[model samples]
Target: MDHISREVDRTQELAGVMSKIEMNHRAFCFANVKDAKFPLVGGLYNSLERFGDALGHNGPEPFTHADFDGRIEAAKAEPIQPLTVDSGLTKENVITGDAINLHDLPVPTFFELDSGPFITGAIGVTRDPGSGELNIGIYRTLIIDRNHFVINASSMSDLRRIYSSWEATGETMPIAIALGVPPAMLIGGSCKLPPNMCEFGVAGALAGEPIQLVKCEDSDLLAPADAEIVIEGTVNFSNRVENLLGEFAGQYGPEDAPVTQVNTITHRNDAMFYSIVAGRHPEHNTLGNVAVYGVQRSIAASIREVAPEVIDLEVLLEPAMGTLAHVVVSIDKHSDAQPRDIIERIFAASGNIFPVSKITKRIIVVDDDIDVHDPVDVRWAVWNRAATETKFMVIPGIESWELERAAKAGQKSVRIGIDATMDLEDIDKLLRPIIPGIDEINLEDYLD
Candidate 1:
């Protein structure tokens, strides 16, 4: 959580040029990266342990998965209001008229196959005209020109919903892209909170303080008062451009993205642009993982309400899977049929428990001994516990996202679930191998 306000040459147009800096900084947790004319903030949420540290919970002992989940769940309960300020640091340098240019910013082309430079960390802020509720989410943008940029409006997002309404009424949706805010604010933007809730409020709850905000000069939108940079613009629904956009999964897929026309660009006098290179990188994947995990927390809570035996749940860490393609759950089994019952209930709770169930294709169930967050433990349970032929079950003819489409059967997809837990009857008799007193050994005392 270190901040450095300095300057560096940003004329380098090569893609992934700054990714080396993010990679190097990740080697050391919370390392200060002051690269280019503006300081490139890297290593933010590079790992789950570092993410816990950034959230101000860096105790003497490393945080466990449950510790991380508890903090996120607590924030959802009581959200704090953001403070309104007359002016913000972002307005210290405002550019308008013909001088507005995207090249001036250190927009890095992360991968070699990317079509052009992209703004990976910019959180697009848009408001629903009908309800006036503000929605903030991260949408990768391509710099097409000085004032024109193509925004990826794919996925079932609140921002996309607002844009659809604007398109229906033949109106342009006003949007403000905020970059380089506090860590909490950036993480808040990545979550898909309730439609009525604002990410600014969530950020305030995480920080345990009200986030300072200032009204944009051109629009009725509010932005972080201390953000490094903010770009205000309007997106035309009718005028669109189709491009093989580069995704975080390292694929160039065609998306008819909405085009945004920049109206004003604002930043601080010593603005440091924060860039996250897209691909299967931790910096990019970790953002979605943390946000999606918050939603999974709520989903797990709902599942526990119906079935109290469910102990822990986690969305697998695969960037190509788009954060929700796979899920792992640990439960205190009571009956032989509990595993299949848990999977059925979870799948049926789609849209209610999971806002986007299409992103999940596989769900695995394990006993309470297995740590759902630990891949090694989960794999071990899967290999040793499940009855390979009979425990595996599949449900077909389900809705799916385009990225995971396997057949030309419209939106239909298949889901698989494996009962990786031991048989209920054998649980009491069979015992897992373990060394005596191993758990009592203090690692710190032994290593030092």
Candidate 2:
């Protein structure tokens, strides 16, 4: 299946399935989890708690975005996006101790190195203190204790900005953390969106319906209809520190960050828990690419309006860093219209997306003859087709993302351009080699 079908199938998989709590308790967290692309959810899930079915496929299986977008549409087709509540979730919702109980549900410890039981895929919904807009992000929640979850709103993120505003007024930020949301919602909320756009709206675009949201028991925000578990609470303004947890970056961080006070715990009676494993691949790295396609498609559409024959785009996420870096465009541009001009325009438009590691050092502009995703072939193009000295262009001092490379103070990067195409002189006659005997004799016949 492609990106569209894969996304649809994901929603169908979640449709009416028991809440994530049941999925986790029965399939993973409570079991012996392992680490592999297709390990049993038990072993794979414990180590790879970010998404439920995490697997990888070679041979151009399909863009994972197809799965994200397809499922979103499948979900919107459902009659109702129901909101189920939970017990041991939250009571009245506080930024500190929940007079309510939290020990009632089954939370899992992902990796042994983790601080404790971490909330792997919690969709943290907080009211933007500045704009009063709803914001949903996948914030890793650390269980500091029974009643406390360490909110690692690093001073660098917008979450910290919202938390600061609430702190100044001597009030805690109301929060609702939902789990087991449809796969598309997870992909949409995984990154920092535009200040004016909500993740749910993006989910809607991918899913093809207005994301049906339900009001949280203790707050005024809305969550997905199919979320399996939810913890409604608030961020304690006074509690500035809590335990830090391990992240996908393979580093332990934010040793002490803001903490959330549980107030109420609400869910379906047999609620299941869900967590995306931090290090696993296929699912581990593909979620961001799904969102990138949406952004890429939007950008490509605008560019295609100006320049047609743009064939394909490839987005690579740095497993350890650089969440937003991209290598895009395999167009069939055949004019002096300038590939560098169009390529540079793409980088300039939405390049500094919030926490990208780096813009591609080489923005390889190719002839339709090249396949960008295949490394061996791309290399062949660079050597046999593109002449690097004349084709490569560099733009120095452009920061693709400011949040990227914080450890380096004066870091400046140069973008690259590679023209991988058959020279116009030979374009009309070039042909791939074909074996002489393939159509005349079958290998299977000789084997027999």
Candidate 3:
């Protein structure tokens, strides 16, 4: 990991450093910040390639479709058991009530238009009041006061379901925000896995060992034992503060949000405070991309069961119109009618697959030759394969998980799809010439 000296200002320095590291595809931590009690760190999952490396794709090469599929399957199958430890590093330093000050943690205000400093990297852990099923997710927590913060969870998120259940029964929901957890936990928290799958278990699988957990002092909920900081809090059923929460999309989230009353703060003796620049940043986009890939792979597998022609799918989260708004699917087309049928099946699978079915507003289907992950290749396919009128179709009045859309239109949206696949019957006439043996050539040995 790379370390930045305390000479750089904490307010905007970390964002600049993270962007550079992302471009260079390196992992690093900012070890010091001026006047801050703890060191700040970012860019742990700065690139998809780095995430691929963690999943055993360690070579200095991009992850292929097989590598990605293998990693996802491993994470799904090897569910590591979480061990409840007697005590851990998270419990080393404890502060409660009068001594608690949220501002002392060096939470930086990322953008000029942001409402306030936010705890962007914490994994908010909540459980169902009736079933006791645990749900851990990365939610935006806006610091409202010294001891209070607002949690902004999307409508489709499991956290909202748990919150709603508590509200129905008139009970305050106990929660624990785990910060500075291992990279596996962060990636796991952002992933959109099956409803029954626990993120802690997935994190453990990613880490190649069981994750250690410790019960919070105020709540029965457990936080990551290795985390730098753990904030024990409660979300009251009736005590909510309305504010425009900051989002990773560089806009204010919904005005109404549930308030978290911080009861206690526990951390390691020499803890490093972890934070991320939320608005349109690489770290935020990377988390979104991770979520997209998990959902994409799962949904694609489910779709393949019905439509066997489906090869792969890519959710274009980064450098797309909006995060999780567009998807590109590849299929081995046999007939002219197959593309439209696949699109219908994808839309029908909305009941089973999450995030993809909820957040995606557009989809484009292409042939196997068009690499969906490569924007240039996909754009080329779109230009050569699709006709404006015949290839495109729009479906209106769909469900949306995005807060901005839900707030305005009551959680409804319109979706569009593009058929960018070539007709098999005309393939002989339309086949393009290929430069043979190019794939086997080593460009560095020949030129650079």
Q: lDDT per prediction?
A: 0.73, 0.54, 0.75
lDDT of 1 by residue, 196-312 (tens): 788878878888999998998788999888989999988877678776555666666556778889999999997877777666666776676655565555666656666567888
TM-score, each model?
0.81, 0.62, 0.81
lDDT of 2 at 344: 63
Give candidate 3's error at residue 7 in angstroms.
7.4
lDDT by residue (189-275, candidate 2, tens digit) is 765555745666655555445566766767776666556667777787666665545444445444566678777665644445565
- Clash pairs of candidate 1? 7-37, 8-36, 8-37, 8-38, 9-37, 15-109, 16-109
TM-score of 1: 0.81
Clashes of 2: 48
Task: Judge candidate 2 against the unseen true structure and give its global Cα lDDT, from 0 to 1.
Answer: 0.54
Compare candidates 2 and 3 on lDDT and give the better one: 3
Q: What is the lDDT of residue 103 in candidate 2?
A: 41
For model 1, the superposed segments whose C-alpha errors exceed 4 Å read 1-14, 27-41, 48-53, 63-69, 249-254, 305-317, 320-323, 329-338, 351-357, 366-374, 385-388, 403-409, 421-448
lDDT per residue for candidate 3 within 208-297, as digits (tens), equals: 888899989997898899899999898866667665544656566655677888999999998988776566666677667656666555
By lDDT, rank the candidates, best first: 3, 1, 2
Lowest summed lDDT across 10 adjacent residues in model 2 is found at 1-10
